[model samples]
Target: MSLAPRIVLVHRTTEYEELVARHGTHGQAAFFLASRGRDIEEVAERSRRTRRALDEIAAGIPLTWRQARVERADLDRFLFAPEDVVVVVGQDGLVANVAKYLAGQPVVGIDTDPGRNPGVLVRHRAADAGALIASAVSRAGAVDELTMVEAVADDTQRLLALNEIYLGAAGHQTVRYRLGRDDDRGAVEPQASSGVLVGTGTGASGWLRSVWQERGGGLVLPGATEERLVWFVREAWPSPVTGTSLVAGHLSVGARLQLTVESDRLIAFGDGMEGDAVELVWGQTVRVGVAGVRLRLVG
Candidate 1:
C-alpha cells in the first residue's frame, strides 16, 4: 500500500440541484413546486444538510493525505486508484451507485439525513467521519465484504452492481430474449417480457423483494454476502412465439444466467442506473452472475 492512501469522497446531485437544473433556475423550480403545494424549502434544506455533511467529511481528511471529491454523474469518467479509501456521503442508493465503480477499496458510508433516510449501506453519521476515517486508514476498522452482481456481454464488456443488474427494454414495451441457466443448456426458454432482473441479496429489500412477493416466493433470495444470485423474468407474456416456463431461478456459485436477444434491441443496466447501460441488439448474448469482486464496506 502507499504510504498515504488517497481518500475519494463520492456524492450525488441532490433533488434541489436536479430541480434547478431542469427548470433552468432556482426561482422557476420553486414556482413549479409551490404551484403543486410543495415547499421548495424542504428540498433546499436537504441540500444544505448534504453540503454540511460534505464539509464535515472534507474536514476529516488529514492534510498530509491526498483526496478527491467525485460527483455521481462523473463516476464513469473518474478513475480510482488501488490504494484509495472511498467515502460515500448520501443515501444507501448512493453507496450502490459508487460500489459498481470500485474494486477492493474500503468504503465508508456516511448518512447526511439519518432520520429521513433509514439507510442500511450508510451506517455512520457525518459527525463520525473523523474517527471512521482514521480507523479505516490505519487498518483498524472492520469491513464487510458485500457480494455483488456482474453482467458480461458477448463482446467482453462488463458491468457490475452492488444491488441488482437489470436486462430489459429501454421503454415500457415487453422485450424478447431467450433465458437459461449455464448448467442447463437444454432448458433455454424464449419469452416476451418486460425484461429480466438478476439481483444480489443486498437487493432483496428493494425491487427484488417486490417481485418475489408478487409471485408468492417463487425463488429464495440470498443474503448480502451470500455467494448466490437470483433472477426473475418480469411479466412474461405467453404466446405461440414465447413461453413463460422459465421465469425464476437461482444461480449457484460461479453459475450464470444466460440471455440471448430476440428483439431488435434491448438494454442492460445495473443498480437502476439506466443512463449508463450496455446496449444489446438482436442475436447478441450476455451472461449474468454473482461477481467475483466484492464491496469492502467499513462501518
Candidate 2:
C-alpha cells in the first residue's frame, strides 16, 4: 500500500482544508497540538464547512482528519523533520518563536490578526495593522479572514500584542525613577530621576517618559552602548514640619525628607502580564531584558 502525503498541523485554524485538498494526507495526514480548551468542536464544524468550500475549488479531493495529544518529545520530532508542509495555527507570540525553532523549515503561520507577519522588511519599520497582514501574505503564505484558504508565507515576522501595553504615573504622586546601565564592573550609583522609562523601539512614541520639569522623556534609543531599554522616575520630596509656634507665625524646630521611589513604588506592566512594583535602594539593582522572541500574527 502507498502512504499518503503528511502535513503536520500546529495551532488549529480554518485554513487546513485548502492545505489538505491541495496536498491530501491520503489517510496518512495526522494533527498534533496542545489542548485548545473546548474549541475542538467548533473546529470540526468549521472543517466540514471548509470541505464544502474546497469542493468548488478542487473537485473529488478526499480528506481524513484525526488529532492526537502533543507531548514534549513529539514537539522535537515535528520541529526537526522535513514534512510535506507545516501549518502553524497559533497566536502572534506563538508564530514568532516558532520561526526560530523551525528556522530552516517551511512553517506557514495562520492567525486572525494580520499584524504578526513582517511583510516587506522595510528599513527601520515598526509593526502596524496593515504591515502585519501584508507581511504574512508576502512571505508566500496566503491571507484570509474567518475562512479556509491556502496558507501564505508573507510573515512580516515581527511582534504582535494582543492587549495594549502602556507606561504612566500611578495616582497623582509623581514617581522618582532611574535609567542607565550598571557602571564599571556593574557598580557605581546608577542615574537617578523623578521619572525614567525603558520601552521597545516601537514603544518609543508611547508613554515611556512621564511629565518631567527638567527633561520630558522616557527612552533609550538604538546605538546605546550596552542594553536597549528606557527608564523613568521622580527624585526627592522634603517634608515640612509646622510646630504650634510655626502655626502661630513662630519658627519650626524639625523637618523630614523622603525619596520618591521609596514613598511610591515604580511599576512596569502591560497586557497579559502582572505589574512589577520596584523600590530601588541606592546600592541595589533592578534589571530588565528583552524577551527571546518577537510576537507573530496570521490573517
For residues 259-287, write the lDDT of model 2, one tens digit per residue.
12232344333322322222233222234
TM-scores of all predicted structures: 0.96, 0.30
Candidate 1 ranges with C-alpha deviation above 4 Å: 1-3
As a TM-score, model 1 comes out at 0.96
Candidate 1 residue lDDT tens string, 97-127: 9999898989999999878876789999989
In candidate 1, what residue range of length 10 has the lowest lDDT sum? Answer: 1-10
lDDT of 2 at 188: 21
